[model samples]
Target: MPNIQLIAPCLWFDDQAEEAAEFYTAIFSNSQIVNITRYGEAGHEMHGKPAGTVMTVAFELNGQPFIALNGGPAFKFNEAISFQVICQTQEEVDNYWEKLSAGGDKTAQQCGWLKDRYGVSWQIIPNILLEMLNDADTTKSQRTMTAMLQMKKIDISELLQASAE
Candidate 1:
């Protein structure tokens, strides 16, 4: 037998790392908290305080593994890199988009691009997008791409319309 384990995504938060982890776990199915480790007494950096103050939390989301670290203010999530979620239907897109865009600024793009309250960027796109963009006709793909470039949250119906000559 071979020993194999899946790697998990690590996310750093200023102060709401735990809160964010909880929120995310609640949103996705087949997700739960694995562990919550706090700092130790005589902490190296957080000395003389409650050592274990949610140092780390392991959780799963829709079978995807993730780890949240309660690190001090050092780095913040920017719009440079974002997570892209492929949805099967319009309902899935709407569900995720609505929740993630609740307190964030929204820019209507062709495909889908949304920024959350934490300034983190996300893409809520449909799985069919790939097929539409990879159409045999180059012009169709180009049109779809153009449409996506103009909007923030991608609407599948619109993409289809744009791709259809």
Candidate 2:
């Protein structure tokens, strides 16, 4: 048996597994497509995909393994499951937010959460946001939360100012 991690998230897509894998690998550093699996004659009736068509693309992002599966239209991604990207700097948050949200649904954006073109929800969050929200000072945290609720993409400086206030 091949060595595998304990858990790996599988992203279901309607025949866009390879495309999503490539897009994700390009966005994050130290990421790449690890393997590709294709459909075969077996189970053709149920799957309805042609033989040799991409069935799954195994990939990694920042060393976390994931699989993009061409699972057809029976299922879809929802905001209930989101990948939270904890960034240490404002630039990192902005970079990830811009790339992940491109060509995505604008109406889905709220409080640093966005649905990508592939319908995957991502939370581009600054690390300091958590610290501020968890602060012992209730007033500071409440103010920060209020400021965060009004914006789609989180601004670190604005959050800092809100907490100070």
Instruction: For residues 1-165, write the lDDT of model 2, one tens digit per residue.
Output: 988699999999999999999999999999999999999999999999999999999999999999999989999999899999999999999999999999999999999999999999999999999999999999999999999999999999999998997
**Candidate number achieving the greatest TM-score relative to the actual structure:** 2
What lDDT, from 0 to 1, does candidate 2 have?
0.96
Specify the poorest-scoring 10-residue window by lDDT in model 2: 2-11
lDDT of 1 by residue, 59-145 (tens): 888878788887767888776678788899989999988888887776522348887766667788899888888889999999999
Off by over 4 Å in 1: 1-3, 46-49, 107-111
